[model samples]
Target chain A: MSASSERWPLRKLIFDTLFFAYGVALFADALGAMGVSAFHFTQDDFIQNFSHYATFSLLLTGVMAIVALVANLRGWTTPGDALFASPLRKLELSARPWSRSPWLWQVVIVFTLTIVVSVRVTESSIGDLLDADGLQGAWRLWSGLSQPNFNLLPRALALAAETIFIAFLSTVLAIPAAFFLAFFAAKNLMQGPLALAVYAVLRALLNLSRSIEPLIWALIFTVWVGVGPFAGMLALTVHSIASLIKYYSEIIESVSDGPIDGIRSTGANAIQTVWYAVVPQIVLPYIAMTVYRWDTNVRMATVIGLVGGGGIGTLLIQYQGQALWPEVGCIVLVIAVIVWLMDTASAYVREALK
Target chain B: MSASGSPLLNVRSLGKTYPNGTKALSDVSFSVDAGEFLVVIGLSGSGKTTLLRCLNRLVDPSYGEIDFAGRRIETLQGAEVRSVRQDMAMIFQQFNLVPRLSALTNVLTGQLAHQPTWKSLLGLHSSTEREAALEFLKLVGIADKARVRCDQLSGGQQQRVAIARALYQKPKLLLADEPVASLDPATSHSVMDYLRKANRELGITVICNLHYLSLVREYATRVIALKEGRLVFEGRPEEIDRAWFQRIYGEEARDVGIQ
Candidate 1:
């Protein structure tokens, strides 16, 4: 017998215990529905309305049990033997039968359950989504967008400029800090256990900082700096610097060993070796990474402003809350245009550098 | 050989055993007089590299005494070792030029041990150093390509640039680790010819690791053969014959001539 067969009995025992516990809980709930329980644990309303789907659930459960048993029997049967014994052998697909991929039916069941649960939890109705009331609301938003408020154009431009500036300043602040930290974080530079320890600590710090979103960081900073562009910049700087360290250190680690060897053979000091050999290799990629971070920061800066960290996002949130769809449309348009321009420009620069 | 006052390098009982327990070299005792083209030959992993690196203390010998220019080398550390290294230069099989850098900048980097850190970092080399770099590039016959990025050059040209870089250091001794291993036969000859010029004209003591027996015979003034990290033979290149080849390599290894 296979090694897994030894564990099968134990697994079967665990499954049986779980099934018995579930049955006991269901029976207890049924008694509670009849007001027979001392704890007064009420049954869910779902069971009272079970008449609607009882027949369907019973048939589904029975079929699922049979399918599960067949799938479990797969471990004991070889594909060739199962195929030879199968009545479906003439169909040609039975050469391997169900033995080769016993998990397929389980996957289908899980997927279907997920969809059913999601539909119930979300209370989503496809008919409601396509109804006239929803279509009318969508049309109103579209109509407002088509006739964006030109009067707020100048204000939108100013806020957009401020948002871009915050991103630029934060990215600029992040660059040098990330560049310095990367030396400590890069595995190639971690020569000894102590250096590796330093790398691990620095890596953990970066990961910790990166795990908190820029918006959340902005909320924290807004409390500290009292709500301004500086607070937003601080948030972006902290988040971007950590992320940039991860990118920059990876690039440093991947630099070809040839140049490092050549440089080291010159009797250059550690600093000189890194300056001459490693920096030259990673400079282009570092710049590209920084510019890419700046693009993301610009988008994030706009978002962070919703929490009172001074930018166009503050105005977008205000206009949205006030139901001034026309003003919101103008601000969004301006942001879209600027983001598109930055993306195109950075792409060109990266392409040229490459 | 010239009857020099003293051998330029004196090495005795040099050996290296890696942390993982691979013995790279053992009981390796050798010396080199100035202006000798010494070629080390062996099958791969036979410790020719470990031997060459030991001279400059690049790969520190676990047990050895190395006297270079009358100073104990293996005992030196940090700045002292660096100061000794400033007098020696190395070229590699891969050429090792910064691929994104202009050829001239790559050549100028050889002066890194001598120049102040900011000078090279800022690309502000003195006119004399810049002139010397260009002259070295001219010596390797790649003066016109000084402004070109190293990655854009052919393998031969890149190796030539590497030679120029090493030469620009004005090092008294040059260590070349399989410097022509990656090139075509003709290109190999071209690179080796520049190395020869450096020895003859610059009076730089040369030590190199080589694979091709023919190249060893053609270029080496003195030859040392390694078999399984042990020094098996040391003599003039002409002394290595069919039997010696079988011993240095293996009984079954035929001499594969590259033309």
Candidate 2:
């Protein structure tokens, strides 16, 4: 017997209870479906349907159970000496048989055949695949290359510029604000009830801003700022503050306590400690995170513009509504290029900072 | 102010109790004359570090006064404290040079108190200060690695850079807290040698906390020992024999407490 079995009969008891409960539930459901009035069945019609399905399910279940039992019994086990060796050595010793186990091959064959049969059952005709209502149209929608139009270039460029501008302006404004909030949030810097209160407020504000997606924020800002890049910028700014506060606080927490302790030991005041020590340690990571946030905001700006917040998404939406597939394709291409460029530039700047 | 004659640092009955209610130092009294090389030795948690930090008011004492150069540091506030810090320097066991900064820049940071915050932020050190920093780096024998980032240096080299930074401050007192505790045997001697040279040549009072009894005997002119946050021994290096150390360390101090 295994160590677990020798130690307690708890495992056997649990297994027996579960097995009995499962069988009882299964039998009760079957009888109830057969119009057993004592358990409340609506009609005897269920008896005919239940009998057919239950017989089929029973055959399938029995075959699966026997296969599982055979597979478990046939699996390989290492010798006692090998099993008791250091974990790494034991792993190496046991790996060969484990890999070559017959059940592994059986499982692979079963999975492959299941997929093949599924594909055959679900397969559609090539004519239907090529039809405008089917796979061909879906492919065109995905690639945006089946029909290409260059006429939307100017509008797309303008919207892309708007997206970049909004992201840049908002991120710039959010950085310093996040810095202050993060300082208050850091436990080493601020202590006591007042600090805790400030932390709670900042956390709530972060959650509130992030909870309402940027698109929703854009809609709200559109009402306030009258629907332009300005509204988009405002929305992105609020969202960036929420995101950056979390990132900046984590960065502040990871900063080396040495410099902070050194400053405090010098009898420097609290503000001085933050200015001299905390700021120095976090400066590089802060700049890197700010650049990353700007890149993410640019991507979000495009999505926000679908609701008239002013970006490439606006141009794409216009073409889409007009059924000008080629024009929409052109707009999407421009957006992709802009996003890729921003991502590459962000990576380059991050590397330089490191 | 001439660095002469008078004791550079004076501590009278200093006591510190942490917020968690652990008493770090109690009734500690010590004074170092100008240019004296004082080394404090004790087992771990014996408040040797607490005493040294109390001199610079780094870890503020809960009760008592520390007077450095006739000014009571424990009572100093704001700019007064900054002024005092400008006049004193500390070296850490970890050689806490800003790892991302060049060795020269680390040394320049020592002069930050003298400059406007704007200048320090912009890294606009005066040309004279820059030259002096290089000169001090040469004194510590790492001038060639001036432009190298601190992380690239070996432990001993990093400690040397730390010493150079403290030297650039032109401090009246250099408080080193177990400066060589993290270093290997060979490197520890070199670091101690530089500290001794600074003490003898520049008349800088070098007060250090050391774990090694042999190193303390070789380096320090005056030795101070503590046990459980109280002053237990104060005498010349020759007077700190096996019996005196036994009294200071007791049964708990085995390999660490004896020479």
Candidate 3:
């Protein structure tokens, strides 16, 4: 057989060692669980549980082994006429242009190692985690899925309105603040220590606001302003600043500096420079970003509501705590529908802007 | 408009050393008479752009006095500088029209100095000003594309539109910095033709920087050559010979200019 057809010795050795180790670990665990003593490993209750739990995993490994075997068989070649026909083997193939690439082989080795390790780690008994009592409770929960209570519809609609209001208010508030911060951050627009200081301050503020999730912001606002949509709006506004600042700054940075220089050459003051050059270039992008942020804020508003910033999630939380499964499902469905519609509308608006 | 009047622009010992300590222009002194078409030529880093920009105080000269139309521009501050800039319109290599704005809107932006800040912000231009913008657009030969966005046009057409915008400013002096560098040969010729026409018809003192010696030879009445931030040659186009160009551009001249 040709050298290419021959099995790689190191690969074969590593595969065999891993397979043996897995088998030993499974056998040891099974023996210990069955209360077996000494070196003798017996097949008993532990073996039954282990085999039942690991049936799917064992099937997967067996399929992988079969596929590898087939690949090996395909690579095999006869020795006769191999010298002239398989000239690639005789030539310095490693010196070829493509042979310099090591990333492909690295990925293959890493993937194979991960699969082997995963198979070994998950071979023990786990069926007890899904016992009859546990399964029965899950079945009961699933069976409760039916029409939601129509009586709560009014409250749901009101909360939905609150969520929309919060999102709208917050997005509007964030835009102007982000606009100034973005100009400060753009390297082409500003230079030196002042620019650096402004950038650092803006970046720190953005990170600080975003680092504390909207849920945490809602909680803090609830304590400060009392539980209402106003609290929710304040929370969304702060969070929106963080998101908009990053997006606005990126847009500012990408703007063609040509017009800016042209305007500056006209002896247009700083404010005039921004109005004439920067604003004209970034207006469309800014509008698109605002619409997208509004959509995101709408989703976040609902989430924050669960923490007492009033919205649809607050009502959903109440129903969930009372085991109103059908109502919970309905609320989830409503949220999904709203998000999908908003996403589609936002996409259309963005396309129109472009 | 008198033929023997004082020069429209005067520069004395103009020098610029950037923040990074690189000298862009040094000891540059020149003057342009009213209604003069002076073309400046130089190598890539020869500081022609810096010198032109210093006329309006765009690039603040480290040591100089720029007196344009009898006004001391080098000492002007804030509104005073803006007033001088209003009288001096600049055209760039890239055309520099706001891409998103329509050609008409871009032209109207030149009238920004004349309009109230709030009125301009609201985009409320007087009907007469709008009509004048349209007239200038027609003069530049793209009046049909008045409502079209600038990005929709070819490079040459955009540069024409930029020239029209500069005309809309009604400036006494026009500065064009490599205005035809981005265009092909035919387009470059057409743009230079429009610039020459504007200079003659409007009586605007034109100071243009050109890289192509042939274009300068064909169009400019007076040519100024700068080398290493200093004026190396200054005379009428007829006076610029092979030896004079070689002195200014060195070995690179054999590859450049009309062959």
Which number leads on DockQ?
1
Q: Considering summed lDDT, which 10 consecutive residues are worst modelled in model 1 chain A?
A: A77-86
Predicted complex 3: DockQ: 0.37
lDDT at residue A50 of model 2 (Cα atoms): 88
Better of 2 and 3 by DockQ: 3
- Cα lDDT tens digits for candidate 2, B11-58: 899899999999999899888888789999888899988787766766
Across residues B120-183, which tens digit of lDDT does each residue of candidate 1 receive?
Answer: 6676888888888999999999999999999999999999999898888788889999998899
Query: Which residue pairs collide in model 1, if any?
Result: none
Give the least accurate 10-residue stretch of model 2 chain B, judged by summed lDDT. Answer: B250-259
Q: Is candidate 2 or candidate 3 better by TM-score?
A: 3
TM-score of 2: 0.71
Best by TM-score: 1
The CA lDDT at A36 in model 3 is: 78
Fnat by candidate, in order = 0.65, 0.17, 0.45
What's the C-alpha lDDT at position A133 in model 2?
Answer: 73
For lDDT, candidate 1 versus 2, the one ahead is 1
For residues B45-126, write the lDDT of model 3, one tens digit per residue. 9999888888877778899888788777897788888888888999999999888788998888887777667776687988
Per-residue lDDT of candidate 3, residues A1-354 (tens digit): 447544443354335334434454445444554467442333464476676547745664666455445443564221111222235543543344643433234334555655554554465445756788988977776666456555666767777877888889999998888777777766666766887887788678778878999889889999999998889889999889888988988898899988877766655666767788888889999999999999999999888888888889888889889998777767776777778888899989999998
